[model samples]
Target chain A: MTIEQGSYESPIDRSVFDQFAARLAGDLPRPTVVETMTALLRQEIIDGAYGPGTRLPEESLSKRFRISRHSLREAMRLLVHERLLVHETHRGVRVRTVDVHDLGEIFAARRVVECAAVERASDDGAALAVVRAAVREGQQAAEAGVWATVGTADLHFHQAITALAGSSHLDELMRRLLAELRLALHVLADPRRFHEPYLERNDEIATLLERGDRTAAASALRTCLDDAERQLTAAVAA
Target chain B: MTIEQGSYESPIDRSVFDQFAARLAGDLPRPTVVETMTALLRQEIIDGAYGPGTRLPEESLSKRFRISRHSLREAMRLLVHERLLVHETHRGVRVRTVDVHDLGEIFAARRVVECAAVERASDDGAALAVVRAAVREGQQAAEAGVWATVGTADLHFHQAITALAGSSHLDELMRRLLAELRLALHVLADPRRFHEPYLERNDEIATLLERGDRTAAASALRTCLDDAERQLTAAVAA
Candidate 1:
C-alpha cells in the first residue's frame, strides 16, 4: 500500500496528528489553534505554571491540552524558536531564563527597529490610526490594572506603527523580537512596574506621530525605550 | 511495556548526521539528535542542495539522511520555526522564497544592528581582530572568484562585528536573519554579479574601520548595503 502524504487543505484538527497538519494548508486565521496554544502557554509562563529553568514535559502537556504528543511537540518547537523556551537534546525543553544581558540586547534591538518604524508611520497617515487605537487600548488596560493586557496592547501599538512602514519583511522580524520581549517582561518582579509607565510613554510617542513630527516621534520613542530598558534591568536584578 | 516519564541519556552510535553537528557543537555545543538533523538540513539549504520554492519531502529526506521519519519531521519543524523553511501541512516543507522586499527589510534590520555593533567595537580593540580576519578572508574569496565562499565569509565578517557589540541576544537575531539572507542570495542570478562589487565595498568599509573613522565607516557600510540591495532587486527581477 502507498503511504499517503497527508491532506494538504484543512485546519489542523485538534484530534489526530495528520489531520492537524492537513488543517494548516494556507495562511491560518488569527486566533488559530497554534496561536491559541501559544497564548495559553504564554499565560502559564507569566503565571509561573512552569518555573524558570524548569523542563516542560511533552507527554504532560499533551494530556493537559487533550491533543496528541505530536501536536504538543510541534507547539513546543515554535516556542523554542521564539526564545520563550529552550530545547536541550536529551535533557528536554524548559522555560527559557532571561538574564540582564538578554534584556538589554532585546531592548536595544527593539529601540532601533521600533523607532525607525515610528518615523515611517509619520509619513503614512493611514498607519497612524492603528497606532492611535493601540495606544487608547493600552491606556484603558492600564487604568483597569490589566497589566497583561496592557503589555500586549503596547506591542500591538508598536506593531501597528511598524505596519505603516509597508514592509512585511520588517513586520515578520519585529514580531519575533517583540514576542521575546513580551516573554521577558512576563518575568519582571511586578507586571505593573513595567506596564504602568508604558501607557504614558506610548501616548506621547503616538501623539508625536499623529502630529507628523517624525524626528520628535523617533526621539520620544528612543526615550521611552530607554525607560523600559531601565525598568526591566532593575526588575531582573531585583 | 510501560513508557517512562523521563528517559536518561543513552549513548547512540555515530551516524553521518553526527559529523556536521559535532563540528558545530565545538564551542559550547548543545547537541541533540534533532538539532544535529536540523543543522544538516540548514547546510544543505546553504549549499544550494535544495532550490528555492522546491518542496522538501519528509520521506525523501528521512531516507537520505538515514534517520527515522519521526526524527526528520522534528528537524523540519525546527527549521520552519527558524524561518529557514516554510511548511504547508500535507504539501510538505519548501525552502522559503525571499523576494526583493524581503532583502530590503533584512538589510535595513542588519544596518541598525550592525552599525550599533561597530560603534561598540570602537572601544574594544580585541574584537577588531575578528573583523580584520573576516575582511581578509572575504577579499581572498573574491580574488579566487568563489562568489559563494565570498558571501559566506562576508556573513562571518558581519557576525564577528556584531558579536563585538557584546550582546549574545543581537548575535542570535543576526544569526537567524543571516541564514535567511544566505538562502535568498542563492536564488539571485549570478553570484559574481553581487559578489564582485560586494568585495570592493567591504574593503572600503574595512579600511574606514581600520583608520578609526567610525562615521565614515558607518557611512560606507550604508552605501554598500544600498548597492547590494539594488543588485539583488535587479537580479530577482531579471
Candidate 2:
C-alpha cells in the first residue's frame, strides 16, 4: 500500500514532535480512531513533517497511525474537504499546493470578513479584553522567541476580533480561513518572516478597539492584511 | 442490512421534485455515483421530501435510492459534514433539527457577514446589475405567487450582495450559511410568511445599492435580517 518512495517523511526532530504531542495529547477520548488520526495528521502537517505537495497515501498513513484503511479514508476525506489535502481521482491524495493567487484571494477575504467584524462590533469592554489578551499572548510568545507559537497566538488575535461580531457562524468561517491561511504560510521560505512583523500591528488593533476607535482599528487591519498579502505574494512569486 | 422499515419515503410529487431534479440534473457528470446521489438527496432535503427531525435510516435509504449501502453511506457522510443531517451514535442519521437559539445566532451571523459585504462593495455598475437581476427574479417569482421560489431568489439576492465583496471564500461561507438557512426554513409551517415581505425589502436594498447608497443598503439589510429573525423566532416559539 505504500504507493511512493520519496514523499512520506517521518519527523525526525524529537523536540518539535514533542510539542505537537503535548498539545494534542489532551483531546478528550475520540469517538472514533479516525478522529484521533485526523488530529494527529493535521498537527503533523502544521509541524511540517510532510512538506507541501507531498503525497499522503492512505495505505501508508493507516499503517503509520495504526488504524484501518477505512478509518484512514475517513480522515483523508475530511482533510480533502477542508482543502488541506487534494484528492485526485486516479492518483490519490497530496498536501494542497496553494499558489500565490490563492493566498491573495484568501487575504482579500480576510480583509472583508475580519474588517467588517471589527467595524460592526459594539463597544463591549469584555470583548475588547479578550482581543487584548490574545495580542498580549502573541507579544509574549514573540518575546520568548517561539515564532511558531507566536503565529498561533496571532491567529488567536484575529479569531478574537471576529468573535466581537457575536456570530458563531462567522467564528467558524474565520477558523477555516485561518487554517487555509496557515497552509499558505507553510509555502513561505521563512514562515517566521511572515508573522514577526504582524505582532505590533495586532497590538495596534487591540489598542484601537479598546479605545472605541473601531474605524481606525478596521483601517489598520486592512493595511496590515494588505502588507502581509504583499509579503506572501512576493515570497511565493519569488 | 434492513435495519429500519418505516423511515423511507419516495417523493410522489414529481413537480416539486422536478424543480430540484432539473437544477441538480446537470452536475457535470459526477466522478462517482455517490456524488450524484448526494446532490439529489440534498435536493430532497431542500424540497422537504424528508422533513426535519425525521430519521434517515441508512438501510431504508439505500433501498429507496436503489444504491449500494457503501454509496449511500458516502452520500450521508457528506451531508452530515454539511450539517444538513445529524448522525447519532448507534441511532443512524436524521435531518438536523435546528433550534431557535441556533436560528438567532445564525441570523446574527448573516447580518455581520452580509451587511459588511454590502457596505463595503464597490459601486460597480456591472456588479450592481447582477444584484438587480436577482431582485427582479425575486419579484417575478413573488408575482407568480411562488413564495418558495421567491425565498430561493431572495437567498440568491443576499448571495449576490456577498459576491459584491468579490471574495470566493466569503461566497463559499455564505453558501454554507444559506444551506443552513434553508434547513431553518424547513422548520417553518408557512414558508410564504417568511419570504413574502422580504421581496419588497430585497427590491429596496437593490435600489439603494444601485444608487450607490451602500450605507442605506447595508442598513436595510440589517433591518431585513432582524425582521426575518424576529419572524422565525416567533414562528419557532409558537
DockQ values of all predictions: 0.32, 0.59
Q: What do the candidate models score in CA lDDT, each in turn?
A: 0.72, 0.78
lDDT score, candidate 2, position A234: 82
Tens digits of per-residue lDDT for model 1 on B1-238? Answer: 1112221222343466768777878987567667789888788777766667767776666766677887788788888877888877466778777777778778877776677666545466667777878888988987787888888988898888777667666688789889988877776667777776767677777777877887788777777777777877776655
Top candidate when judged by TM-score against the true structure: 2
Candidate 1's residue-wise lDDT over A1-238, tens digit each? 1212221122433454334344443365433455456556665565555556777777666665566677567677878877788877666788877778878877766765676566545366667888889999988888798888888898898788667666665577678667767656655667787678778888887887777888898888888878878887887676
Stretch of 10 with least lDDT, candidate 2 chain A: A1-10
lDDT, residue B60, model 1: 63
* TM-scores (chain A) of the candidates: 0.77, 0.87
Which residue pairs overlap in candidate 2's backbone? none
What tier of docking accuracy does candidate 2 attain?
A: medium
Off by over 4 Å in 2: A1-6, A9-30, B1-6, B9-30
Query: Total backbone clashes of model 1?
Result: 4
Which candidate wins on lDDT?
2
The alpha-carbon RMSD values of the candidates against the true structure, listed in the order shown, are 9.7, 4.9
